[model samples]
Target: MRQHGLLTLGAGLCAAAALGLAAPHPALAAPDSCSYTSPTHQPTLTHGDTGAAVKQAQCLSNMWGGEPPKLPLDGVFDSVMLKKIKWIQGCHGLPQNGVIKDRTWQVLYHPALDCYDPYPV
Candidate 1:
């Protein structure tokens, strides 16, 4: 009788542990609903216009809540601001190229990139 009880208890604990490992915690689970959108269009990166540079600068400025480094929007790519952009990319699981790619733009524009709702009903 004692052995049978111990066996049952051990099996129950093992099952509980398996379930815990298989199931995601509430915090880790995806939200039931979210509102987000991707960038409709890419920034125009003209040879001398440097749209990517301008967008990156704007994003950094918005993130830091201040004026960004006065870098030329001519494809020069500011090293300092590039580093900050890379950091932002890293945090958001982006390519970290320091250049504003489409994915980066999407994240920059949308508040809920991870939980975007293409067509909210």
Candidate 2:
């Protein structure tokens, strides 16, 4: 009787192992959906006057999903825009200072750095 019980337990263990091997874990499965992609590609701001900064802001706005929150892109560093950019930086897991630092630019423009595909259209 004991021998029969041992055999049954071994068979159950084998079946469980087989089932585990046959199916993928739920965590490894793909997500149900994702968001739309952005349009613009890597954008370089001229950085000398307000116009350049504005242009950068526009490009950033497009990348984000709307117009940039009115930042002076020509290197003037508008306070409002700076706060907004800081928010963006926070989202991107960077320093939140509202300044367009080089690291922030890398995350914003060159997402992949080597061959980034600037979000979606």
Candidate 3:
């Protein structure tokens, strides 16, 4: 058996067709999987670092998905993460030192849609 009278909607009928029944709301956008922290609070992260900050960097780095593959989000800055960081840095014309500092943070947060430099094999 099933209930029928329990189907109550919005108090103001807000759940109209505009809510995707007929068309998608133009202003709505789903958030991505990554989003580890506020951009302003990014710490100076380097290899061997671990914790939320490292996780943040890893998450953001995954946003730049390319040749190397997405990181594990384990918060450990291993050699693989280092190479990816260097590639991202190089793409932004920053020094490819494999250090996730201020400028690197900027790129990680706002990565270019396309990178001219190919990911190294």
Clash count, one per candidate: 0, 7, 0
Q: Write the per-residue lDDT of candidate 2 for residues 1-121, one digit (tens) a residue.
A: 9999889866764564454322111222111211122223223333332544344543443343212323333434454455555555655678666556566665554332122112211
In model 2, pairs of residues that clash are 37-120, 38-120, 49-74, 50-74, 53-73, 53-74, 54-73
Query: If both were scored by lDDT, which would come out higher, candidate 1 or candidate 3?
Result: 3
lDDT of each: 0.42, 0.41, 0.68
Error of 3 at 87 (Å): 0.2
Candidate closer to the true structure by lDDT (higher is better), 2 or 3: 3
Ranking by lDDT: 3, 1, 2
From the highest TM-score down, the ranking of the candidates is 3, 1, 2
Q: Candidate 2 — which residues are off by over 4 angstroms?
A: 1-54, 66-76, 110-121
Clashes of 1: 0
lDDT of 1 by residue, 1-102 (tens): 999988986676467445432211123212222112123544533222445446443433243211132323344445555654555455566776666656
TM-score versus the correct structure, for each prediction:
0.38, 0.38, 0.69
- Model 2 is weakest, by summed lDDT over 10 consecutive residues, at 28-37
Query: So what's the TM-score on candidate 3?
Result: 0.69
lDDT of 3 at 80: 92
TM-score between candidate 1 and the true structure: 0.38
